[model samples]
Target: MALTKKGEFWYGTTSGDTQAELRSYSVANEHEASRFAASKCDCGCRTFALQSDEDAGVAIRTCTDCGQEHLMGDSADHLDDAAPETHECVCENEVFELMSGVSVTPGTHDVRWYYIGCRCVECNLVAVFADWPCDAGDAAAFLAKV
Candidate 1:
């Protein structure tokens, strides 16, 4: 089947006195380069952040059908602010906020990559991070951090 969003995506809900909504996200910022795939929903239906190539101080995200881009004033890709290129992967210690830990194999060590963990502060063990393109040194530096 196609990867098009058709059904009503459960953005959030209202329980007791709580309400939630869908959020767009980005993998980079203006000072930094962009990463990951755009125009797709994050893992599960949760509040996702967005990044952009503009200087509105607001993040940008495009709608799948209409192709209309939306602005998010609160989201950001602060990797440049704190996380440098060295912490770009798992094999290192970059798995603090949005990752568990980096992994490598003795066999396919030359052809492997790392995965991200989670960024949610309220829920522990809740991973919604995606695969970020990285290299060996990046992973090594990450490991050195821890």
Candidate 2:
């Protein structure tokens, strides 16, 4: 399924009104993607905020209801010797909602490209934090694998 939400929000620093609007967009984006990669918190909440460190190939999802966090994507074993750093929005908020865009071949399940992004819960700034060329034959499995 494609993105089902739309509004007049930009993809950068946002005001209170635009922030809320973008959050709605993010929630919808997450829901659509769930058809491929379903996830839920222990609290039974399906909504979550997301964050990631591209260098570490790590993505984190935080439950919106109970504040629990889950790690997405692959392990950070490759970054065992890397320095630690913090990733936060300009608003100083570490919480965000995950959004993604995937391009699959027509009439087939193969995926050609994938882009994962984060929308700040505080300021609603949206950005594609990670993306890569893909040759996945199973779109759903690929999304889940990421």
Candidate 3:
């Protein structure tokens, strides 16, 4: 029998849109990588892993091995978990900036990137966000106390 490659692995760009640790290929196959991408972001911007190669470099949430990609980040109103996910995004766009609001999602942790709003040519959109807190309790307190 030929050696059977019976597993899933994923590879991705080392560059992230957020300030969190730039996640590279974590597993041996594609399946796991897709899972990792869907599990929210460090900056609360949600993730959907992509596979980029030299030819088709940097497609969104796309897997080069399986040719399957996920294109997300249009909406900004869901919390899947409390892992304190943050967002890394492009500096320029047509609409809003930041991820969420400090009021709705207080700046609890030091390990997050507060969306300071963006300078779109036509409009500057301000969003809200939060992620894994450098001080989880302090963040929670700030959210609760005020």
- The local distance difference test score of each candidate is 0.27, 0.51, 0.22
Backbone clashes under 3 angstroms, per model: 14, 1, 31
Residues 116-145 of candidate 2: C-alpha lDDT, one tens digit per residue: 655566766565545444454667765664
Model 1 C-alpha lDDT versus the unseen true structure: 0.27
Give lDDT tens digits, candidate 1, residues 1-146: 11122243221111110111111212221111111212232322323332332222223433333444333222243223422122222222222222213334333332123333233222222322333333333434433321
Model 2 collision count: 1
Which numbered prediction scores highest in TM-score against the true structure?
2
- By lDDT rank, best first, the candidates go 2, 1, 3
- The candidate 3 region of ten consecutive residues with least summed lDDT is 26-35
